[model samples]
Target: MDTHITGRTAADIADSVRSLLERGVLEPGDALPPVRTLADRLGVNRNTAVAAYRQLTQAGIAVSRGRAGTRIVDRAPVPQEGFAAGSVLRDVGTGNPDAALIPDPSRALADVVGRPVLYGEPVIDRELEQWALEWLGADLAPRDIRVTVTSGAVDAVERLLAQALTRDDAVALENPCFLSAIHTVRLGGYRAVPVPVDEQGMTPAGLRAALDDGVRAVVCTPRAQNPTGASLTAERAAELRAVLADHPYVLVIEDDHFSMLSHAPAQSLIGAHHRRWALVRSVSKFLGPDMCLAVTATDPYTADRLAMRLSPGTTWVSHLLQRLAFSLITDPEVREGITRAGAHYAERNDSFAARLRAYGLPCTPGDGLNVWLALPAPARAVAEQLMRRGWLPRTGEEFAVDGLPGSAHLRLTVHELDDTDAERLAADIAEAVRAVSRSGSGMIDR
Candidate 1:
């Protein structure tokens, strides 16, 4: 298939082919037609075709033989590790929510102890599942919602997609996707189609294109979109709903991973249509990630499919854990703690963004438990430099879909920084960005 690169560069044309192969559109050992035929088919010059082929060959994706024609070299290159071992920079790049902010599971778990469901017991805890449905249904309102709890939201999404898709089936996802989404798609052996996002969230054009390309599932972040805090606006969510109406049967999974941590009003893409869908709001961010629980709401049909996967041999989610989550959510003290944490994250991140701007680094701030900032150069070099300064920050590269590379950005857990620590760390990051840009070097300034 000729990748449509009508308005794209010659190299972009090549990249499209690479992207296609990465998505399994081009199978291993599959023969590509002669360069001339490809150029004619794609409306590109023969020289452009030659360059594109050479580019693919150098990427270890395709190989050339005198008369055998170019063939796909099966297999993917190992991904380079982006984060330094135990090098989480103190100032920024800690993807975790503030430890102090997590509702003390101690107090919440104090009340929970239930009789374990023994052999021959139903796989799901009926009361817990019913309560979970009520809690998860809080935002989206009544639909064909059914509750299916798994180890966590990641586990939930993985099982949900597996029940619906096959290996190499196209799964639409936001570009610069959540880390768990990337891992889930990879583990399931599914192809990810990148849908571009902006301040208002997933672009309509990108989504329409993905649908046209025959995607089987979509994984979207409604609010507190990781890496960038951009969320779906009310207008934008309505637009997506309108756009998705025609394709209701496509499984749409929305991950509200940072639920209740931001003051921003929730807007949903899944709310638009009544088709195969699941909206997962995990307690990881607002509640502690260690809770190991996620509230998943899916259509009745999809829930039935997931129930089979949750049956015996799985043993189901622990009754104790579910009761703990239920107790915590319903607790007045815990709810107050959540509100306090949301305010703390908002204020601290805003302050950090202010400091960055003071140093001439601009950023688009939004509602997340953390802040996203653009580095003067690629984020990796800046991150390495920070490590030498005794700080660890997460770069944008780690959060993108396989064929798409995230840009010069960093995600910082500003809420964890004290006032003095915040100022010093900001200065250190600024200096590091400048140093890497000047030397074009990977070594951090000692």
Candidate 2:
């Protein structure tokens, strides 16, 4: 009998598997012995082997496939938001704001210089905090809230989850979720319970299902959701809030990342009476990614816990950055420029969507910096064809939580593309879809 996975206790066996993984003895996708077989071999209860596999799954080291048994998960780095480094193709997949649209900080920076902020002082800049309070208070009105500053939306979410959840906790995320959110949940060892999103935003049925599954935290993008650009309608938001009202203790995080840039009106899923909720607005979208700052408004209890993690003399955001962000955002000229920028993004995306529709492809002018184009063929195959035609696009599969096959959508960032480039890219996508359909390599979902 092979004694490779020899251990009597669940933790012991899980540790042994990790050791084997570290030594490259058990490669990714390699199936482990059946629980019963392993238990018999190790002279332990079958439940012990099951528990071992559960531990590995929770740690993201392995995956359980029921009757097919468990296997080591491939830990390759997931794709993130940015330009593809060194790619020669006309990259339309990059989910970036227009450089021309970002407000100029040169004048703001010159005036932002102030006294050096010493340790043990307040982490948040007083001016920035006052501005953020009015800003966040406008939307999250009637509910008493406390504000906390973080490096960015992603940073705020990580800290929020860390304060509220532990390992193996379940977090409800949108099905075609934000890339950063997916990565954060996985890296934190939280099981992501996917909630399906429709044109109006997160479905009430999906939210209910996730809550029923015992998710401890729910992360939602109320407006301009990433990848799909699905904004929550007021009716949908009301429905979701009603669903969430029962679970008042569950931590709800609304990442309104596209606060200034979104063409859609703001809608929220956090109920007025909910006890634990947060609204995170980041300036990275309109102010440029270099400005790493996000203002978060949360219930007082969550705020207290988050403050401890972001205490003075530790991980507090830099006062200089806060001052600079404040100056730029509050400047009347900069605010006017930001409004124009938002309009620019909306117009470009709308034009591209119209171009795709002209080519017989279905696409909606969703709110965001990118257009979620639906194709008649598999997104991966079409993406490959587009690459050959001098274009780079992000397949919807890259954004899917479950990595389901036959994804027929591509997220294209065409706002920066000129009229000629936009038309050419749209024509190329139509051609690629036709070619892939003719090849019949995979079944098309749509």
Candidate 3:
């Protein structure tokens, strides 16, 4: 079948490609014609064909591989954190907090429903704003800051990037980045400049290289960085800030997703003198994912821009939800529960890491819901062996940025596992590694 893409103008050409995709004539991985070939065939200028390809790329309907040519994006759904649907295997890869650890919102719901919020009223609930101000101000003091309520950390990041960046603008992202962050960047049609992350968080040199490459914005995870669970140390934070001291205008967004649930103290990359920045703290980790409320603290200018997108009467966050979150977070009993939850995650993750280490795997219990287990063989090979043993784990390659080499690690969420299961998993992981080694299939660099 001759898959036809027929049009003269750029918009028309792009629309034709979309039509072909819709009709199943142009499948994913199918390459569009070279600009010159398409132009000659359609009797249009070469630039017109280029522009059409660019439009498709920006819409995420296609991807450009330079000399290799542009091809359709798969459009398959990206894997998200949480349970895998209908899986019979024991899932140790679900990046979810223990449901029992989340604070009960039943008691707080009654106190939060005092009054109905109407249009033209302040978007943020007054009580929530006050509480959020104090909470964020403690970390980002002396600098003028304003609070904006977003649906969640992902929403805040998307909005923040939209407000500060235009399509095709470059943004710095961690090498083994969070899934949502990667999706957000790609969907926004922005270029993601990879910054390598080490044990102490994003390396200063990597940040410098990204800044040198002209990234307009940088998204950082201050604590409990997803996937690897790496947190920035005080010294490393200072070094990163120093590197950014020169380029103070680049918008810096810190997504502190595991805020109340993180055992590590927050180490900020946003310096006092920085011109534009945002610190986003979501309540989902401690209050439950369904809460869907995140408090973003940012410079006045950034706050103003974000507010425009979240303007009252149209896109504002629900005042009732904000009030409920504030009520639960400030309650004494809820506070204790959050603290205990943090401890429980830390203890369980540590115990699992110790067991993996005893089995000869170089696993570390980072300050998050998962353990990053370094494998001597390929992570996929080990994961395959694990699956054969009725276990499912997330491979580190899934979190790695595009253009980077495949990873030799696995991110396992073992915090919910009891001692018996934990031990079994450890033993299974050891057996998996040994099986891979004996097969002599996937030996690669660490």
Candidate 4:
């Protein structure tokens, strides 16, 4: 293992460490030299070494031990699934929307370019705000709701948490949560209190327990929750609202990431009378990830604080991108395309899940772009077997927030696959499960 660390600047040193990590040159539990020793070796001031260490800690790449020194964290880094470069295996693990379903922005771009915004201009595009409010208002009960635009859902969540909660404050997050949300909570230094989510979304008992634990904020996905593709039923949403009623002051954040694509209706957890709340609708699913625009409907107080952080000339989302998103959403042809795309995703996911069940592996197709397939064997073993069979799938452990061994499950994005590919994946999945079910390693009953 390469354990050497050398750089004149803090950022340089941090980048070097991250590169080594990505290349697997330095594994977890490896120790770095003392700051004084590293500073001398790198020919930099002692403060530079300290800053580099601090940067690494903030990024969750390394942990500091009081008298012992700094070392790579023993835990596996959060899993991020990117395109499998140079791999001939059929990839079913990429957590992404179907590329063909995304509406082309070329037509919308013509209408998006008229205005050039200047400093001190309105942070949000006027037309976009009006349209967003109209769409959100139909679902939300009458109230004084404020709106803020952010680059993306993760960006909005990070800013919202920073504005409302202090470091180490407890924030309730769904168990087997969205990967980005998990990263946001961890990187923000907020304590994550896991609330179990079933088919109907976050369980009432789980929310009650988290509230009892004194979580200052609650993050929920009202529809098409990532990984599991779970949506909140109206009854379950009401139950959660009742639980949250006593604690109205807690900041409730609802990430409706699949707003346009969800086959389900919006079952909100933020009651009309809730004090501080935000409902984020990211357009990435419909428009494309490159759009990077999300409209946030928030309570006045939270919006005000978020505005403080996103002040003009600093953190405001670009108006050009906002207008481009708005143009696409308002276009009739694009709306029709989005509607067709939603149905296509639902059909594909359901079809894939049905095939899995037919093969004797239990699986359910939920509201999102992915299907959650519960396996009889450990997800790791099954995934390994599938990889050997020329497929890549994500294990449920990647989405677990509690750091415990996860239930046996695989989160697969098979909605983009054709009938033959989907069937092949299902048959392979069943075979993999049977091959590993008796191995007796990391098996957890759902």
> Candidate 3 lDDT, tens digit per residue, 1-446?
12388887999999999999999999987888888888888899999999999999878788887898888876656667888899999999989989999877888888888767786788888888998899998987478889999899999999999999877789999988898999898778788998999899999999999999999999999898888889999999999999999998999999999988888888899998999999999988888889998999999999999988776434788888888888888889999999999999999999998898888887777898888888888888999999999999999888876734457889999888999999999999999989989999968756
Expressed as tens digits, the lDDT of each residue in 57-171 for candidate 1 is 6555676765988877655443332334454445455577877777777775667876656877765567677877776777785676787788888888998898998766789
Clashing pairs in 1: 88-392, 89-391, 89-392, 93-394
Q: Which regions of candidate 1 are displaced past 4 Å?
A: 1-84, 88-91, 108-110, 122-127, 403-406, 440-446
lDDT of 4 by residue, 52-106 (tens): 9899887778877769988887664686755656778888888788898898888
Question: Backbone collision count in every prediction?
Answer: 4, 0, 0, 0
Segments of candidate 2 deviating more than 4 angstroms: 6-15, 28-36, 44-73, 311-314, 440-446
Taking all chains together, each candidate's TM-score versus the true structure is 0.78, 0.92, 0.94, 0.84
Off by over 4 Å in 4: 1-76, 438-446
Overall lDDT per candidate, in order of appearance? 0.78, 0.89, 0.88, 0.86
Candidate number achieving the greatest TM-score relative to the actual structure: 3
User: Can you give the lDDT of residue 203 in candidate 1?
Assistant: 90
lDDT of 4: 0.86
Give the RMSD in angstroms, all C-alphas superposed, for model 1.
9.5
Instruction: Compute the lDDT of residue 166 as modeled in candidate 2.
Output: 76
